[model samples]
Target: GGGVAAVLSFGVANRLFTEPRERGRTIGTMGAVVGIVSGGGALLGGALTDLIGWQAALALPGLSALAAVRVLRIAPATQPRAERLDARGAVLCLALAAALAVLLQARTTHLKESLVLVLAVLAVALAAATVWHVRRVPEGFLPRLVVSNSRFVLAAVAGFTLFAGYLIIQFAAPRLILMDHDLSVTQIGLILLPTGVVSAILSRTAGGLAHKVGPLRLVTALTVLSAAGLLLAALAGRQPVALVIAVAACVSGFSAGQVALMAAVPHLVDSSVHGVAAGVFQLVFITGGSLGSAAVGGMVGAMSLSTAIGVLAVVPLVGMVAAVASALMVKRQTQAPAPAAGPTARPAVGAE
Candidate 1:
């Protein structure tokens, strides 16, 4: 329910703001709110767990229900589309995510080879089925319209790697800090709190920046900044300054990258598919997060934490390269001479 609800914010932004800068600014404000809330929640949940029972932290999510009232009040007026519900596709998606989660973590965690092989086969089967279903029912789960747009697909891929690196730093950093400093979870949370405050401001700044600097360039630079953070962690995580840089970089990357992508989506695909496009784009990237977290958990026992983080840097580094390539390609295309069009020439997508 939360995941479904999460996707709606971008869709609403897309509907409400047609201009790129305005939408970017709106999404940045939204991202800032998320950063502050989640950062505060980390501290609150940690305190609750330490001061009271672990179960006390469970109440935090119940507080989230209060937001639904606001959601109802502000969500754009929307009508239900009458398309067939993609039940099979939805089920396959859940199954595939679960299977892949298990399989990815199975390796360095030392699961029985036979069990790993079985889960591997199951994941492959589920992934195959999902692809077949999406292709067979293009208008269903993943929508042919959204998938066909190269910009949309590229943005999704960039988002996935950005999140993968972010989560890797998140999962890896706290454990390393605890191991090194023996800090309480609450203290760690407090130490990280500034990241949220700073990132919130930077994210909001990114909104205005998007108007002057191409969003793709900002995104690529942010991704590179995150990868560099991980590299610093790999090299000097024991140092206080590097640790702060590591945590702050990844958090900023995700917060600002999300704003950039959210604003870019309306320009990537038709507004008609805005809702689904935002949903699928989020799912892909957040799923990358899950994998990154799993990778750290699976590999920590088998390798040095620094080595694990260095390995993690590769994910976002890949994203940075893709982002750079995409920006260049878009620039070249933008500069190229327009083909002579007949009466039916459609305006380019970025014109929106």
Candidate 2:
């Protein structure tokens, strides 16, 4: 359900803004809201569980969703159009995703080595088949033109790698704090609370900065900052103050980078395919997070947590390189002559 919301929200965001600068600001504002909610969620959940029960805590999202429905009803609607649903592509993608999840889970479970290998092979095969089939189908589930754009491809890579690093911190930091310091859940939440606050404040500023500095450069710089945060986490040991500072840095960088990446998406693809492109971009983002969590979990099971974190620090550095490449790609594309309009080229529905 969260995944569905993410895809739909991104699609809506893409259609709602055409000017890159405005889009950046809008996305940054949205990121601020997300940071506030996510930052407070842990503390709220702990309090609710303590006061009432776990069931009440679990119902919070449903209540939020109900409130969202009220807002959505009053929102302006886009023109509806019909397109053929690519059933084969959909099935293949679903199968591929499931196989990959199972493969990842297997690494942390007591599954036999042979079974893990089989799941890995199945996932790879499904992925290859999905790509092959999508390329052959005109107007397939995925937008071919958007996928083919060098700028979009690099942006997707940048999103994936940076998000993986962020997820690693999210998954590891709480565990490290509890294990090393023997802190209560409430205490842990308090220690990490500053992260969300810093993220919310930075997110709003990041959009304007992206508008001035360019999305690629902003993303690259934020990613480098995220890498530095991860390095700090690796060396933080049991120091509470160091951990708080490190986590705040990670959260701020991650939030800013995410907004910049989202702002760049619409410019990289034709306006007509905004919804599909956003969905695909989000899918990549979620996939990276899942992979990061799985990789870190598996590593922790095999070695010391600090050692695992230190190793995973390389992920954000990779994202930094990808961001640089994306900047170059966008520059090259902009300098090149404009190509003839294809089937996907249409005026954006909600350009202001």
Candidate 3:
């Protein structure tokens, strides 16, 4: 998805710039831009669909894409030419992802379809093969250098947990808003506005706090807060005022924590493979969101709405465990003395 692309680009750009504070500001601005565009699109699309046909409404975005291509063609290349494209690995990875996507669609949307299981199994196999191939192949799809770092692994796990919690809440929010409050889509967006706005405003500030208090601690605290928020939302379900506040708390905390994560991940990784590390982090976060959406969607479909919301809360609880592990790991690694590079020269006891 283009949203995934945009966020990945933001991560890579932060790595390239190597300025933490500026990266926070840039990401905040990007978030603001996204909020505006998404809000506008919702309103405009609704209007267009109501006035004209849905097909005609879709044509507008197609026209916009044509204009976007022209703009992109004129844009200057900032990256070095030395970067080699891993064509085979890329194709294999994409194919595996496509298969997984199809399987998910079939399982969720077309339950009667028997081919989903076969596709899912094939997808898993292809993905495993892709990973194996990449490690052996020079300039493969996955950047080998990035995966070597323990920090990258930690960051990815933390990112996964964080996004899982956030997306689960996101999937549940609209249902709660519509069913509990009997609000229109427009009203729901307006109610959600404060959460997004506060998050955008606070993220840079959160980044600053993270710099002072450390991302590991900030992330842990935020993870706890996110879980608490979700629990509160679950308890406050069908209660209009409390539900809104609870959802706001969940969204704002999760988003601010993401900014802190982006800032910390690059520094945690080896400098030589920073770009690839950031890319991996982004990919993990996106994949986690997908999984979270699926998990939440399924729970909502099968169980009661309150149960779905409560189950979603467990995602952030998992995030708390990850955050605590990451914090302890970082502390242990940071505090531990580095081994001497060479054998220490022994001073003769008599000479001393």
Candidate 4:
């Protein structure tokens, strides 16, 4: 639960640092650290699990709690407000998400036909209810200001698809290597270890690159890189080198794209709703990742794993359109006609 709760803090990244470049740099450094640590952990996890047991592979994340304790000193203070919780809207939103989750899992879980029917009905009902609630209360559980923004949508979609691709690679690579190679668990991890190295290097530079290339192009390029990785895995993944390259491309794109794009959220949305925007983006990230893995797991039984991955590539590709649109939107926003105000009035940055 602590691990899950930890995701909630992701929104704080935007809140912590105000400067765009600084935010980018910090997020990139974070990506680097995570990549390096994860790479080492992957190599070690295999050896440790074989030697000590699976429990050894799982004990390390607990250390993050200690890091959190020290971090509290720098955490932002709470701003008390008297607005009541939108319990009805919250319940509706949760039900809607739950319904969608059930549908995504249905294929993998292979629920009974009757159960599927019930779930389908529940999903429709929940969807309608949630939509009605949102319309009735635009500023309720899901704020209009947050959800309606194109940039926020891109952030959500980018995180969603990038993570989907990330999860797909994670599931596909190890399985591919184990099927063809007679390598030890540790050896397989070693083969996959370079993904982390590649990811770390790219992550470290992503911020500066995004600043240079602009968010739209950078995100599209990364998405293309990710899709190419998936395509390689589908077409030539039997070769260990191909799989390694595939995973590297996929992970590097995910790591760099996530940090760079998220850092740009402040430029797109109002400061008051940064938290909401971040929360929505991360929620979509988690959902899309789950759905991505679920898509692979559900389809691999009926289709080739490679084909499933090729199909999965569409997730990021669709997100690329959103990313491009987001960039265009940013351009449009920046180019808005200056207010025809008196000389005494300063220009205000519009936060739609």
Candidate 5:
């Protein structure tokens, strides 16, 4: 599921648009669709689970997949290219994910100490191997140009960090609500519905604004808003109304920030490498989400859920700093003068 999403996100966005303005609009529209589906899915799932059964609710995603087949047929195909599969990189990534999952389980559950130690060692080994492999290979799994680009790196960091914060909220909120307020699954879904709606609206608007104000500026501002929302959620405690407002703000900001980062991808990398760049970007984005959910879940097991959520709020502030740094880098790159023409340079036809 993760692999497919990463591939499709990069392939579709890269193939569909070239110019930044158009890309922003397209990416925004994509975000809106995702927001709708994600938000609506919760409501739909709850209704299905109540009316029918858990099995019926689980089947709904398959139906949506069948519907998506028609959309897939309309997608343009790319020219064939001879590219080596990065099998070692793929294995290393999977190992890392598995090890991380085990470690999270160890932290949250009463697992044997020896098992936890072994998993920790395995996770460290996988991380070291992935880094070494990337540096060793000429044409590595990730493109060198994409990795070296400061703006792209910062954007990736911002995306990962912001998503982590968002996922933490999603993981912790429902549990907190149920524990404190005794809300049913359906009631919890309803409480969270507004967040998705606001996110969908902001995501589309942010895309157009990214073209006008620049993605970094918009992302930075939105990230700060998200941070503020997290802080509010941290302080809200058991207040249902406050929690709803905070969730809406956080989701809206996350949606906008996501659109801005994605819309900036084409501008950051060459057209030819968009597919690879997008894949790397989404890989990190997805990894952040997993780490966020795991880390916060573990923390909740160790301490009060409210305290864990409060600490997790700091993640988005870190993302805001990365966004600001990206904006500064963009400004510097823009202001740097073009190299002076050499003697052999062709003269302008209209030279005075």
Candidate 6:
């Protein structure tokens, strides 16, 4: 949860430090750094666990927290309105979310406990009260305008689909590699490396494409490609040659779509609301990720490998549908003329 909070904080950071060209490089660097640390730490930690004992893994996270503190101290802070941090609303939300988290965990653990059931009901009520509070409270944590925007709603849905597909692939691929094809962990990592490297290289190009072609067209193309790639991956399953090609396409399409979507966001809505809109989209994305992990894992356990792959492909297919809908809406919006202002502000008559 704390890790998720840190990642969420970076969304505001991204919007704060907005230079089109530079933003891409910044995200890429941050992504690369995270990838190296996560991957390298796992590799070293595992070795240390085997040789030096189990406590070595604990040091990695401890060190990471210390590093985060140092970085936060040095990092520039951009003060959005202090009012944006609604204390009462935050407390209610945290309580509700924590309850749900506990209840979800309970299903797999001590299910006989009445406390879990009680907490679940309490969470639902608290969430309802939170919504009511948002409506009535002046200077609350959530802004009414943020929730009311149609574009934000659509963007949130799209973000959910994008991350759902990503999480599904991440969970499924390793299983397909290890159980079906008998590949070692090192080999699985090696196979996955190419996709991440390619994404890092192509992210800048994707951002440029978003600007030049307009986000709708670029995103639509990428989303379609993503759907196709997932479908292909479903078929490839355990076949190494086919799996590699399919995974490459999936990674490229997903990365490109993400870049285009992020670029489109500021253009799709008011700049003042960018931080809130982005945060909502991110929240949905994280929710979808959790759902995807559970859903995919469940399907894989219940059905055969082929069936699991088929189920996983459905997420990207939904994304393709959303992409088409968004493109059409954008086109319609573009074709509409801007409303004229006050009578005196109207375009000059016969001036040209």
TM-score on alpha carbons, each prediction = 0.90, 0.89, 0.79, 0.88, 0.91, 0.76
List model 6 lDDT by residue over 1-352, tens digit each.
5436544555745765688667655654554443343334334555666667778756666666666676677566766764455778868866765666556446444556678768878988998998898788743655667665555556556656666666666667667766566654556666666656555555557766777888657766655665665666687757766665565556555555556666776756678766666565556666666665656665654576557656677676676667667666766777999986876785578866
Q: Which pairs of residues collide in candidate 6?
A: none
Instruction: Give per-residue CA lDDT, model 3, range 243-321, as digits (tens).
Output: 6566556665556666777667755766676556667777777777677677766555467767877877777777777
Model 1 — TM-score against the truth?
A: 0.90
* Least accurate 10 contiguous residues by lDDT in model 3: 34-43
lDDT of 5 by residue, 145-231 (tens): 787788888888888877777777777667767767876667778877777787889888997788789888887887787777777
lDDT tens readout by residue for model 1, 175-236:
77776787777887777777778678878887777657877778888888888888988898
Return the candidate ranking by lDDT, descending.
Answer: 1, 4, 2, 5, 3, 6
- What lDDT would candidate 6 get against the real structure? 0.62
- Residue 106 accuracy (lDDT) in model 2: 73
Query: How much does candidate 3 score in TM-score?
Result: 0.79
Tell me the number of clashing residue pairs for each predicted model.
0, 0, 0, 0, 0, 0
Quantify all predictions' global Cα lDDT against the true fold. Answer: 0.78, 0.77, 0.66, 0.78, 0.76, 0.62
Better of 4 and 6 by TM-score: 4
Candidate 4 ranges beyond 4 A from true positions: 1-6, 84-98, 137-141, 339-352
In terms of TM-score, which candidate is stronger, 4 or 5? 5
What's the lDDT for candidate 3?
Answer: 0.66
Top model number, TM-score: 5
lDDT of candidate 3 at residue 266, scale 0 to 100:
53
As a whole number from 0 to 100, the lDDT of residue 61 in candidate 5 is: 57
Candidate 1: pairs in clash = none
